[model samples]
Target: MAAVFLKLDRFALRQFNTAKYAGTRIFFDPDTFESKVNEYYGERHALETEFGDRPALVQGYAPFCRHLFMPNFTGAKVSVQRITAENESLLRTRYEARRPNELPVLVRFFPSEALGGESALPVARYLDVILYSREQCLKEAQAMGEEPPLEDAPWRIISIKAQDEPYETPMQPITIMRNSLIGEGGSGVPLCRKKYAEAVAYWRERAIIT
Candidate 1:
């Protein structure tokens, strides 16, 4: 059976989990979830090579891009909420003493009406603030263990675990890599996890995973 997912923005949903789906206003659209997963995974050979030597083919998918509208390769976007997480979601972590530039992204919440193909705000357990440039990243981000220079990509995502007191400064960092989610996509309570396990198992049974 196709599992249910809130019919919200897919890029922002890299932080997907049940706590973010708390309210009744969100739609559980299996079709949309399936659709996004389709783009993210692409064809079987594409997955094996990670779309190797064919950046344009992979960049054609919105899941692997930087643009808010869709389809580009500068980077990808993710969203996390600023609250206590209920389960083992991305909210269970924090960032370094670094912060994003003051430039704001879209405001997110569960929408009341059908987005109908319109983009809707996103939700997650923690907040992933994106810094767009190497210069800005140098100014705002704290260096960790001589990590490589910031990529030429526009979306530098930092997953920050936050508090409720209206959000203070000096954000910390912990990573939740998107490529790592290829086959590890369950983040919910027992029932939700069960359904997710069922879906993954179904695909595996068809030789999608070895």
Candidate 2:
């Protein structure tokens, strides 16, 4: 199977809470999701202004939803792997590196023409967090009114070296859909990460997640 990996800094980690100890995983209703996207790119841009350029932490269209459109409370499917030696040195550096090569280049996913809150849409698409097209994203953003542009959005550079494997399966074709649901739930009781095996066993016994 083809898979795409995403590296998140501490800020993105906070929103996803992929790590059980990171605390609460945010509940994004379109609006909050857009806000967080804007926030992330904004800070990344700041880091870029200081440093000349660097490679992006994540590559390929990501933020995939093998389960949650964003992710759920326990962050199932989003496992935390060890900081690879290959990617470690670049991940660890001063807040504002004196040398340009010390940090990675921060960049925005979309163009300046996107305008208004329209910017967040492209960022979402870049992460594969959004399955819709540029047109669809713009439509949604239009309804939301004018907001900060992608370059202008206030958002981060957190010390982190986390890996998120999105596609356990091959990529699927994208189509236009009217509405969708994204959120939290795992039966009546919300099982913690520790009970993962038990939950899987229960589901397998019933063929729920087979």
* Model 2 CA RMSD to the hidden true structure, in angstroms: 20.5
With a 3 Å backbone cut-off (N, CA, C), the pairs that clash in candidate 2 are: 39-155, 43-156, 54-105, 62-127
Predicted candidate 2 versus true structure: per-residue lDDT over 1-210, tens digit per residue: 211122222223444432222212233343444555445444554666788544222332222211112222222332121233442332321122112322322211211122222222112112323222233233333433423123211112221111243322221111001112111100012223434454344322221000
lDDT tens readout by residue for model 1, 1-210: 432211223223333343332221123343453354334434433645774533312221123222112121112212222332332132122221111322222222322232221134233222222222344334323332223443443343322222222222221111112222222221111233444455444432221000
TM per candidate: 0.19, 0.24
- List residue ranges in candidate 2 displaced over 4 A: 1-27, 53-163, 166-170, 173-210
Q: Rate the local accuracy (lDDT) of all candidates.
A: 0.27, 0.27
lDDT, model 1: 0.27
In candidate 1, which residue pairs get closer than 3 Å at backbone N, Cα or C atoms, i.e. clash?
65-75, 80-126, 80-127, 81-126, 95-172, 95-173, 96-172, 96-173
